[model samples]
Target chain A: MKVLVAVKRVIDYNVKIRVKADQSDVDLTNVKMAMNPFCEIAIEEAVRLKEKGIATEVVAVSIGPKAAQEQLRTALALGADCAIHIETDERAESLAVAKLLAKVVEEEQPGLVILGKQAIDTDNNQTGQMLAALTNLPQGTFASEVVVDGDKVNVTREIDGGLQTIALTLPAIVTADLRLNEPRYAKLPDIMKAKKKPLDVKTPADYGVEIASKVSLLKVESPAERKGGIKVASVDELIDKLKNEAKVL
Target chain B: MSILALADLHEGQLAGATARVVAAAQAIGGDIDVLVVGEGVHAAAEAAAKLDGVSKVRVADNAVYAHQLAEPMGALLVELADGYTHVLASASTTGKNVLPRLAALKDVSQLSDVIAVESADTFKRPIYAGNAIATVKSDEALKVITVRTTGFDAVSDGNSAPIEVVDTVVENNQSSFVKEELAKSDRPELGGAKMVISGGRGMGNGDNFKLLDGIADKLGAAIGASRAAVDAGFVPNDMQVGQTGKIVAPDLYIAVGISGAIQHLAGMKDSKVIVAINKDEEAPIFQVADYGLVGDLFEILPELESKL
Candidate 1:
């Protein structure tokens, strides 16, 4: 069985985002970029499955500008057998990315597909479910655990209340959540070996998919800042403020 | 224009977020119809009918939708979405899981976690972990959206709407529910609670979480934890309150021993009043807290509990 993992390059999670001066969009000038945190978990899960012999090969695919190859190479260093980069300069929305991945799924014919539940940049948790709908595949999203057993994969999902386990047939979709697994950093030797790995760069037009924008960005601005109040001298003062000043009690 | 809103339910009981989603639908200025899809969802459908501004309630009762799995639910919504101009649901786990599939099947883009409805097609949503807010406009004919319930006020139950049974039954052979382990608690749900007290990595371990119980019981508050606490194995993921976890904005939020990260602040910063109790004076939690008490939580928890 083959595993196809979709990775995305986004602004680093640690960076404080600054909106552009003209309010057109977020400023990406000289910003640090990295693979999304959730995508790292997805890659780790796929590599672990390959180590366990449940997956015969692990293929990593990413969609972005040409610079996205850096993330695919990182996936290769983490243990993906190969990488594919869908080159697109236009900002690919979730639907466009899902359509591209559905095309890739058709060509690769991987038994399992994995993606990050949401991207840190857009914070939109839509790609995996959209791809599932487009490809007519069952989906186990927000998965913390994936167990492959005899043509069925049992996925333990993290729900709002607790955990829910569901079983899906082969050739399904699974989105990695936060607690899925702790991602491993690539070693120096592996990083060197990743440079020699085969990487295929293709355009969205190559797969007959158009990367078009459906949502227009009208403006971007900072949220209202919550100002900190005075520090209480004692617990009694805190209670007094809550009961009398704020009147929330 | 007609709008279809999906109800959020658990164990046949309607979730409070459904009312909030309806509130968002009402903002769109349309005839709102709520859809309840589940096994034996008559009670939930009746509850949906009572929400203000709802004109009708559509119920699809079937075993296939018992878990409200995305596959069948998405198909059912696609079938029922011909004349509706907008489809809305709460940005809960169920909505986040299913709405995108419906959007894709309809070939329309979905605006997720919409915090403000600027117009019929424009919305304001947070990006970059709530660091920046982006106003977006969708050109798609059919608008699909998931509402951040905390941003909208829940409507009161006043109007009694008519209930209609949806006869469309979707067949599913691709997936099946194996089991579920939901935490049973007497406290109000964190998302809908009036008061919330959350702990973090400073609690040390799972057993230490018991300290918050006394204060919680006294204030009638729901207990939550930061991602650090959940990731540290001090509590379950369901109790997590952060960007990727439950987004809660209660009337009063108290942070106990929580050194707030930005992600954690994103979930509860909208709270009416925030109180922070942590040993670290430099903790980020104090930045957003309306009242700050810097001290040891071990000593503060008991005193806070007894005083309340």
Candidate 2:
């Protein structure tokens, strides 16, 4: 069985993003970019599946501009047999991305697909479910742990209340959440070797899927910021403010 | 436009988040309908019917929807989405799980975590982990939206809408429930809690989390933890509050030992009053805090517990 992992290039998690002065969008000019943290976890799980001999070959696919190749290369350095980049400058929504991925799956016929639960940039958390629905595949989302046993895959999900364990048949879609596994960094030597691996690029039209963005970003703005109050010198002072000034006590 | 809002369930009752979603739908000026799907959920359905501005409530009581797993529940939503021009739900785990599937079946894009309903077609959502808010306009004929409960106030119980039974069941053989371990807490739910006390990596260990218990009980505050605390095994994952974890905006949020990483701030920064307690005076959380207390949590917690 082959494993397919979908990765996305997004803003680094550490960066404190700044909204554009015009209220159009977040300023991305010269911003540090990296593989989405959750996407890294997805690729890590896919590579582990290959290491465990459950997957014969692991393929990493990304949908974005040319810079997205960096994320695909990172996936290769971490251990993927090949990389497929759906080269598109258009910022496609989850629906269009899922449709494009469904087209790729039709041709690749991978037994399993792993994706990040949500991209840190968009925080939409919809692509995996949309892909599963479009492809008519069973979906296991927000997966904290996954185990493969014969023709079934057990996915333990980190849910709202606590945890839920669900079993899905083979050829399924699983979206990785946190605590799935600690992703390892690619070694310097592995990064060099990743350049020699096969990396293919295709336009969204190559899959015959329309990449029209369904949502128009009308405006962007920073959230309301709360100004800091004076620091309390003692516990009694804090209590006085909470009871009298803030009235929250 | 006709709108359908799905009632979120919590412990066999209609979740408070449902009213917020209904309010968001009503903001667009539409005939709002609500769907309650679960086993023995008539009480939830009744509560949903009482939500102001809700015109109708559709209840589907079945074992298949007990957990609202994505497979069958998604199919059920798709089946009921025929004539509706808009579908909305609280951006809870169930909403995140099922809305995209319904949108895919209908061949449309879903707007997740909508914070504001600008028009019938336009909405506002927080992207980049609440660091940036994006106002988006959807071109799809049918819009699917998952509302962030924190954005809108819950509609009060004023209406007496009629409740109807939905008899549609889609066969799902692809996935099966194994088991669930829900964190049982007698304190108020984290999202709706009046006071929230969260610990961070500084708490050091799981046993130290008990230090907050007395104060929590005294204040009737829900207990939460930063991702650092959860990662260190000082608390369970469910107690985590951050961008990836549960988003909460309580009336009073006291953060202990948390250095105010952007992720943690994204979850609780919306609290009406934020109090940061940390030993480091230069902690980033102090910038967004309404009140800052600089001290060792171990020493301060004991004193504060006594004072309370």
**Among these predicted structures, which one has the highest TM-score?**
1
Q: Chain B TM-score, candidate 2? A: 0.98
How well is each residue in B1-308 modelled by candidate 2, as lDDT tens digits? 99999999997899989988888988988799999998899999999999999999999899888778899999999989989999998888899999999999999889999888888898889999899989999999889999999989888998999999998877888999999999988998887788999999989899999999998999999999999999998988999899999899888999999999999999998899999999999999999998899999999999999997
Query: Which tens-of-lDDT digit does each residue in B1-308 have in candidate 1?
Result: 89999999977789999999999998888899999999989999999999999999999999999899889999999999999999999999999999999999999999999999999999999998888999999989899999999999999998899999999998999999999999999999999999999999999999999999999999999999999999999999999998899999999999988898999998999999999999999998899999999999999889989998
Off by over 4 Å in 1: none
List, residue by residue over A157-247, the lDDT tens digit for candidate 2.
9988899999999899999999999999999999999999999999998998888877888999998877887899878888889999999
What DockQ, between 0 and 1, does each candidate earn?
0.91, 0.87
lDDT of 1 at B247: 91
* lDDT of each candidate versus the true structure: 0.95, 0.92
List fnat, each candidate: 0.90, 0.88
Candidate 1 is graded, for docking, as high
Please give each candidate's TM-score.
Answer: 0.99, 0.99
